[model samples]
Target: MNSLIRKMSMVITESLMSQRTICTNIRFPTFLQVSSPLLAEPMKKKKKMDPQIIKAREERKRKRIEKSIKKLEKNTKQLKPIEEIDWPISLQKQKLLRERTETISQPQQGQDILKAWRSYKYQQSLQETKMIDRISSSQLQALEQLRAISEDLYIKAIQMDDLLLPFTAAGPSSTPPIIGYDVLDGEYIDETPKWK
Candidate 1:
């Protein structure tokens, strides 16, 4: 009878411990679920950009890319002819030409030789000026185009009272309450808070 009593007590204690463990496991998950949202990371909000500003930026980027591509094409075209120049033979020919030019331009003992040298020097200077003009021709053309665009923009600005031009023909060329002021439109309604 003593052995049976001891066995029964041990079994009761084991069953109580099992029940407590199962209850704690269920409650632990519920507690975590309740607090999870409070402890969770916050979501980041996306920045809103103006459509007009984004469109203008994209247009500028496109123009820049086109300009760069044009420049690259021009550079490639120039490189093709330059690649044909045989370095060794060209260098030798250039040296010989320089020697001949120098010899012709040198002032000798005779006055006739000095006169010829002066004429040669004058001719060389003329050639150099022509070469400089040729080199600057493309730059001058670009400058003229820029000036024309500037003048066109300036004329448009002067013609319009407002900076922005009216895109639609229905509206007045010059916009706002200044050009087409109507009595019905609430232009002068003051919204300042009255003192109590």
Candidate 2:
């Protein structure tokens, strides 16, 4: 009996749906209208250009290029050779030091004008002592030579695009490395990953 009642309800629902579809079509014919077919040729894009506008844009681009070229030429002219350039006082001091080193030599002998007996005695005693207290002529000459050699090395370094002057220091220990830090959980480390 339950199966018979279910079959009757399904048949009634189907009939009602068919009646609704038929009534909607007759009452609103526009809803059932079909769209027209597509054109064979594709539609043109709406990006038409005016000749005057195009000319103005091109003129602006040309002016920008001209300005950039002028800037490049100016920069080149400003970058004269070091010898030709006028150096500031501080720079002149460095150059003078280099030139002085090249020209350094032994000091000339001169007469001593000490009137005080104590001063005279002190000078005599100093002369008698082993040349440790005084800068001997030969030692001065050797130091001058070393300075000249260092200047030459500096010039060479500059020519090779290595402007940093050489220096020496104690080597880093293996136990606690100087380069990298030990990372701990929830703690900041000195190492930056972006540089690596």
**What is every candidate's alpha-carbon RMSD to the true fold?**
34.8, 28.2
lDDT of 1 at 70: 93
- lDDT by residue (34-152, candidate 2, tens digit) is 45567788778889899999999999999999999999888985765586576677877788566753553334212233346668899888877757545577666766776678977
Candidate 1 regions with alpha-carbon error over 4 angstroms = 1-39, 80-196
State each candidate's clash count. 0, 0
Candidate 1 lDDT score relative to the true structure: 0.72
lDDT of 1 by residue, 80-193 (tens): 556556567777877866665344533455877778899999999999999999889976676677667897755544464753665545655774567775567656878999
C-alpha lDDT (0 to 100) for residue 133 of candidate 2: 43
